[model samples]
Target: MQSTLSGRGFRPGDVHTLIVPLFHVTGLNTIMPTAFHQGATLVVTAQQSPRDILALIERHCATTFFAVPTTMILLAQTPGVEQHDVSSLRLIAYSGAPMPLRAIQRLRELFPGVRLHNFFGLTETTSVTTVLPDEQALVRPESVGLPPPGIELKIVDDHGDPLPANAIGELLVKGPSVVKSYHNRPEASAEVIVDGWLHTGDTASLDEEGYLFLQGRKKERVIVAGENVYPVEVENVLTRHPAVAEVAVIGRPHAILGEVVKALSCCDPTPTLTSGR
Candidate 1:
């Protein structure tokens, strides 16, 4: 899967520096496997700070770097990063979160010889669901790129019926890399996998050229301070209150956390509680 999905992005003898967790899908399925399959060198290091990362790259003569957007931002915007000789880098790939335009531009300036790529995937897909190649990295930054060869994608509305291109809807994926079920999670497996298609909970759309663009999430989950918060779980607890009659939970933007859960509710009319009483 990694060999075919990676295409020309990886080659024999290329040096890869491991920054993302090895246990995660991006590292385990995509980075490590693809590197070994292509006979590339893998450098396992724990240095995370911007200066440390820059030093590691220069020391190892690393050709590839894969990390989350936050880490990439720090690396690209580090003070005096240009002083380091990082010319050996051939590829810089990121996933697991969105990259800001400011960081992307800075990275372009920081490494003109490196190819910047952004991929999108879930742990369920075992990584590399879509890869925004270097050519489309800036052209369609909003799009997660076309699915690799042999992957099938479909967008469906609330009713589970398919929607045409450019229509935002729930994203469904089917491919060899997709897991059939979850471990010891029958209910979760049933909800996520249907007729061989993995219901990715994320809301997305495809353009006329088949480039995918994620809109948001359609499921009950939100990310607050890097924590997964299920709105249903919160709503379940909130309904236990005597004064609460109804509630609707969702996620709102947060400057630092990326997203925070917000719940709207209506109190019981007969037992209305006054604020600050």
Candidate 2:
């Protein structure tokens, strides 16, 4: 059988370690299908420990591991991670959430030979929509890369008018991968899927080269005095600091600005947002 998965560079019969939950789209729709299509072996472990996962990768000589940012950070910062021979890992794909630039650099340090890929998609999109290649991973760390084959992506304004390149707007996707509707909720299905395009509800932009950049969710945008502020951008910058472990930016009520950026953060030992800077 011919494979439509051409752009992806996984070996013909490589081994993969399933880090994400099997019920999740990353594992269910993406990893499982890919492994079956490529005729590769998949390593599954009940316990989700850094040590156990790493050990399995070594035992299976897994060439690929698909996980989110937190798992990536934990695996990289695992106690005595060097003790595990994860040199077999060639491709590290991350999705679900934003991978801070600092973490990306750490991954590079931990696995020099591996190619890091940032994937962007929702459960509604089935799995992956665009992929930031290793070549441009560092160069455009924020970008989620261009669409894969058989997918059509575009940015549109509030009126559903298509926006030009680099203009931030709602990202709409049209392709075979997109679901026709929700199981029973016709109202929800109608609201989200309009005119054959899936309104992703994500505030994003496409660059001149067709690279996709996701700012955040449209409803999550914090407008401070008529200026748009994306929480993810602020969160990315916050995570760059050594002390910060996690951060969540939100839009809070403000009398003047309509909304203001409110960042809730946590750090190991203690957290002082002002002191570190």
Candidate 3:
């Protein structure tokens, strides 16, 4: 991974570029500010093709990059990505949702000398609370990471007591970056923001090392055999099959187990499964 500081040292006037969706928080927070804060140039594009992104980076000599996991996948699969002069990229920050391990690995292989940081947060958190560092990415790819600077994170159980390490609980965050209230919805703010801590309904567990591993959302957890099962867990497993390109796992009613895992996969046209179904 490349150093956060460039060879010439931290340049406040450094130019960064982002090819991101306009409706999202990231575009508002990072992409649009390229010109304002750093005296950097901003490239506005209606389309998000990997080719266009690479071309922009090459044409403008963009130093910083940003995208979601989906876009990163496109970059990895896109032809001639390596042929372009993406060597100008120093930092490549990504976050919108959890990235698949395969995609993360591929990105590492593709850009072995780049810094790929993952920013994790909600709109209510003012865009980001945690930043998954590049060093921990390969070893603990599941970790969304420790809270970013100024952000305070805590995992609390049902009683509002802080849970022990590795125990899954609601993620609560407090920081200067957090939004104070929601527009025209006092009730929604009351439900989420409690004494400065914003209750993010996203379930997560912090390891002893303090890296946060996101589970499914509280509302999305499936109840099966009197146990909680996250669909993302099963989906990740099923997608490991060579034939499966994408997968969605749901809990379905069963005669004995109360509910069983039902996996739906978008497989290749010519498919083969080793599992005896």
Query: Number of the top candidate by lDDT?
Result: 2
Clash statistics: count for each candidate: 0, 0, 0
Model 3 ranges with Cα > 4 A deviation: 1-11, 240-243, 268-272
lDDT of each residue in 106-130, candidate 1, tens digit only: 8988899789888888889888788
TM, every model = 0.78, 0.91, 0.87
Q: Model 2: what TM-score?
A: 0.91
Find the candidate with the highest TM-score and give its number.
Answer: 2
Worst 10 residues of 3 by lDDT: 1-10
Worst 10 residues of 2 by lDDT: 1-10
Q: Give the candidates in order of TM-score, highest first.
A: 2, 3, 1
C-alpha RMSD for every candidate = 11.5, 2.4, 3.8
Q: Encode model 3's per-residue lDDT on 71-145: one tens digit a residue.
A: 887787776678888777777778887677777788888777887787686878656667778887778877877
Ranking by lDDT: 2, 1, 3
lDDT of each: 0.81, 0.84, 0.75
How high a TM-score does candidate 1 get?
0.78
lDDT of 2 by residue, 1-277 (tens): 1222544566678888877888988788877888898788987666568788888888889998877888887876676878889888899888888877777888898889899988888899888788888999899998888788888999999899999998889999988888999999999999999988999999999999999999899988888989888888788788777778889999999998898888898785564557538
Which of the two, 1 or 3, has more lDDT?
1
Compute the lDDT for candidate 3: 0.75
